[model samples]
Target: MLQMAGIAVAGSCLSPTYASKSRLLVSIPAQLHREFTPPLPAFISLNQRRREVLPSKSLQTALIRCFDTNKAASAESEENAKPNKVYFARDAIVDAAARIAPAVANLYARKGGQEEEGEMGSGTVIHEDGYILTCSHLFFNKMDVTYAADEEIIVCTQDKEIGHVVDAYVDLDIAIIKIDSPSSPLSTAKVGSSSKLRPGDWAVAMGSPLSLQHTVTLGIISCVHRKSYELRREGMAMEFLQTDCAINPGNSGGPLCNVDGELVGVNVETMKAHKASGVSFAVPVDLISAIIKPFQSCQMPVQPYFGWVMRNVRKENLEALKQYYPTFPNALEGVFVQKVIKGSPADRAGIQAGDVVVDFDLQQIRNIKEMMDVMVKRSGTPVDVIVERLMLGKNRLVHLTITFEEKDVAAPRPRL
Candidate 1:
């Protein structure tokens, strides 16, 4: 089941920048309703975004002066006076869209010998050897039988091709599909650095939203990290790149490109309704870099699922905590547990908010990324964690044993 990104309410709200009533609706795939029993709608809010300020008055006046014409001027002289700002970026976007469109696949799934009519979601070609990356949820069905070796799944790009699931990592909602012996080498996407993305950077989302093939939407990055509020209910401590890119149902698993047409993220979630311009989320490209080699090689890497999100302890946050609790840990190097999912491995082990994870299985965890690496390296094994718990105006050292589960959507257990 899909969950909302943030708090959502049913009503219409006027957007200051967009001269339209922006309504909020869920972007859950329509195939879920047609192919199987329909689930309840995921409520997500599309909050009004910050507006971009116009250029300075001096610059505008100068442009106006350049374009201003005398009564004696001819048409040829008027054309020469127009501003000639070199904009190669527009051509780059168009070229990139054309180059990448053939690699984006429209997925189709079957259950009990019945084929779904429409596309499930979009996918990206990560390798010229026919390796595709998509969301894991797209492979799931409400059928009793597993997919057969042949004719169970098909991928539609420039031509329809049989696709087989190579590997999947449910924690990041990433799935790898291989086209069964393609005719020729496919066009691969140019991956960009998500670590370098800023809040106001230009973003372009390309996908088959609502089955509209090759649709592209433009927006700016609203936030680098938008944590899911319904993490406990969803069983995944999810983080996403929040943007007002107008993503719809079929947009999931498509490429979220930067201004230079490089893939910065994989489009995953969105907020949309009857009359809403939605906010979309993407899995950062940096996260993919860690395991792309294994994924391309058709190997399932161990993605640790602890059911909690953490962040590096900044000096400002440490100062605030110290002021509130006088005995807060003086040691500044550790990851702070921000949220722990209910009934998860971390929750069962008694992890809580305001707890600083000092050590993981005897290894010091300096940041959240380091913690993730530790989890991946020690998959399916019980590990001891040393956390400094704050209670009664003092910091107490606590040791907890937690076994992380490998992220698998096919398993009956909880997945990330």
Candidate 2:
């Protein structure tokens, strides 16, 4: 063995307990001849004169192995040190916001002969002829009053266009304001299918949260068809698109867009932020047609009656369902019909309360909202409903065409 500069050149490997972990010189090679040169310390010369010596074949072989190992390690370190590239949809956000921002109208209301302009909510232009969609709560304080000709209603557009209410839902928190004779052409956002939304899809929320004009925030769709009662404890029985996007007081009635610069939902409410964080909900874009369709014929905006109260089958509810219906299938997915109204479409069609709805009108039913979306437009139309019912202690599939009833009911209100 040879020793120099506190290094041990031994024939055998040293224990890791006593080895210097910071440096690998002692671990790399076993032998060092007079020609051996350290990377550092300049290999201090004896008497200030350098001596020439030839290295043995074994020493050269060991040096070669050490060089190969170091080369491989350096390559690995370089790979690890390389920075990663992060991709963002900056152009998508900018374009989508441009299309949606023009339709957004900041609202201010004067109630009960008050002269001051009170902050209301946000609105989106659904029609090119100046039809703006907004929340119904924006027009009323304590008593719900119709926007009369004598009352003062202000709708300030992104391009400084003034508008007023043309149509409003009596029950639901949805209304339409119209911009009369605008200075320029209105920019209407393209409406996308909310039925296509999936969990973790990119979601962009543009609204005046806290009255901050045209504020935009980006997030993912945390969930789809989230029930209103789950978040608010007690409120309207409605489905919403739950997201992590921040929604504040004045963000109501604003647009919730997708990555394709299309409107997917309407920003309605923020979750209990005092208890939860990054939780908010939006009304699905399908509801916009639900609020507008009935009024097209100069009739009252009545909710399309499905005559069945159902809940999405989740893991937590599976156990409860098993206790009630012992023969319920363990692999069943979709909606669990909780109640069937007597003499209604579901009840007359032989759909029981415990039956699990798997498909509606040939389309697979994944959630409660999917079924609602189908029934909302087909109020009087007969559609096939496929359900799984337990009969004779076995699961059986039942198919029936049920015609929905059209009844005068208030539109669904936003709960949370």
Candidate 3:
């Protein structure tokens, strides 16, 4: 899902950024099977990484240079001296990078039904215990092997060695991963209530945009209470915190924080057509919280589901319902119920399709979200349903009690 900033991660960890250098060392014991190492060992420079080190004065100097040299250090400085902070923003991002990047990990995986390397994705470490949250597709198949951060994960300010996801549910398109890393720099971002965000609020996205580690981009809330789906991603239904933030490929699973860096949402998708522009999208933080209960302590609690769909009335179709619905107050511009599923609490309460649901209890219904808010609070018990049913071009006031059924989470739904 590391595909887009507004639409999806297209739903993965990230796109590819093959490292061109052969200098970085890697070592995997030959006894280690595919279960613990990459399936295709050829693509990886294992021999180069496996070079052994010896302890000596010269080795000490080499090791020290490797450990202490910062990316900010110039080639000349790195050759003769230790590294120092050269830029303010880099310093700020690096300051929190270790703590934050651990949550955002690079995911290497296999392509669908093929014996080849698939694309990569990123993840966010939500739990200090090493639990992470990422787009589920990053681990999309029977993985031949997996890897995490190495000694240099800190250099990337990312968790180098992350535990692969042992469990996943694509219905939510979200996964929980166990990772290993040092203490975080930024406290896990404060998971604030999503309902607090409004259009035009400040937002900052932090992650490996385009696979460049610890990238940050800023924007404002473009819209809220989104009720949309990613048609390309098999119609994954996801309500998001729409923002103009510049979310690119590798930003998936990273945090969309407020001005103060409180976790508001997971950078998920970006809306795009022919040409890419400023529009971006993110998973609602509350939804991310709901999908993965594993991060409950680190994520905001999710609001409940109301479970219905409605539409605003169009003047062209208004005459068709003039008979049974008469309360033309304000032209019924609010959302109207289209269909209520059978055995749904609405059906149990005697509500039917074609019923123009105007309000719930007393709260006026706007769209799916507001109605859900009204119904979800009354989860088990019945609540009053107010509607104006069209009967022979006349308005008929109808009040029926409705209840909400527990959302059937296993109905082949997308990884929410």
**Among these predicted structures, which one has the highest lDDT?**
1
TM-score of each: 0.50, 0.50, 0.41
With candidate 1 superimposed using the best TM-score fit, by how many Å does residue 208's alpha carbon deviate from the native? 1.6
lDDT of 1 at 362: 89
Q: What TM-score should be assigned to candidate 1?
A: 0.50
Candidate 2: Cα lDDT at 70: 24
Per-residue lDDT over 38-62 for candidate 1, one digit per residue giving the tens place of the 0 to 100 score: 4344322232242222223313422
Give per-residue CA lDDT, model 2, range 320-360, as digits (tens). Answer: 66776565655357777655545555665787867788988
Residue pairs with backbone overlap in model 2:
none
Poorest 10 consecutive residues by lDDT, candidate 2:
141-150
| Candidate no. 2 TM-score | 0.50
- What's the lDDT of the predicted structure labeled candidate 1? 0.64
- Residue 149, model 1: lDDT of 24
Residues 1-416, model 3: lDDT tens digits: 11222222222223323222322212222323434554431122123544332222222322333323123334464356543434235344334433343345555542242322332456665555555566654443212111121111111223344243433433344555544334553234446667789898877777776557667787889888666653233323457778888877767767777655567777776766456677777777676454333344433232122233344454534554444334343345445544343344455577654666677778887443455455445534557877766666666767887654443332221111
